[model samples]
Target: LHLPAPTDPLLRALHDILRTDPADNRSLDDHGRRIGASARTLSRRLRDDLGLTYPQWRTQIRLHHALILLADGTPVTTVAHHCGWSSASTFIDVFRRTFGHTPGTRPTT
Candidate 1:
């Protein structure tokens, strides 16, 4: 999705949180609170600035982290837990959807 250029402070803080620790396990609400905004405002800012829900952005970051960990030979369960996924199955599902195969299998796409 093409996003509007944003100079919103909340958006900037969200970007920093995502960038600082792609694997930060904090929930969206916690992240928003850390930056002194309401969750609703944070969500709206993300949608406005990045054309994505906060969860969507966080999931993308998690998938990237998963791929990196897989490439580094980290166990799948370990990676899932580290990335704050509720379970390995959720991680596998997201990995398959994102990479078109299971984690640790070299992505052909």
Candidate 2:
């Protein structure tokens, strides 16, 4: 999750938009339109600049925010909702797959 800052202007703008709302589930085309680029251009730039496709980057962003909220004692269901997961169970599955443990098992500081 430690992505370096994107040097490309478009990527930086896209990152700002994505960070503004992890729950923003707009299609790539829609996002592209918002930023005045074609989806293909955006996709290529994301891959080149960040080594992540749009979905991958978005998932990472969501998971990062989820960790912060969880550390603050947010409930699983609420965190799932805020992070744009379909449900708490889905979030738990993804979290377990990524971290090898349920969110509740995290050794919070």
Candidate 3:
């Protein structure tokens, strides 16, 4: 989750919003209104600054939070809900796809 600081003010604002609630599943249009930008502008800014679409960036945010919650020994189902996945199975699928292993199987520090 070592993200580069966004140079654009709007992108920074968006990042702050997402960081505050990685579980937020708002549409780009909704988020744009919150940050005082159009969806297109926000999307372009994200691409320019982070080389990611809104969905991609949000997924990273969710995954970062998921890792932290898992490290704290939260149950997978609760973590999935806390991170905005529709269900534990969906979260597990995404987690497995992203990290090549399920969250429950992550090595301890």
Clash number by candidate, in order? 0, 0, 0
Model 2 whole-model lDDT (C-alpha atoms): 0.87
Report the C-alpha displacement of residue 5, candidate 2, in angstroms: 3.3
Candidate 3 residue lDDT tens string, 1-109? 5556688999889889888888889999998998899999999998999898888888888999899999999999999999999999999999999888888895456
Per-residue alpha-carbon lDDT of candidate 1 for residues 17-50, written as tens digits (9 for 90 to 100)? 7656766878878887898988998888778877
lDDT of 2 at 70: 95
In order of TM-score, best first, we have: 3, 2, 1
Find the candidate with the highest lDDT and give its number.
3
lDDT of 1 at 23: 67
* Residue 1 Cα positional deviation in candidate 2, in Å, after optimal superposition: 3.5
- RMSD of model 3 against the true structure: 1.9
lDDT of 1 at 44: 85
> Candidate 3: which stretches are off by over 4 Å?
1-4, 107-109
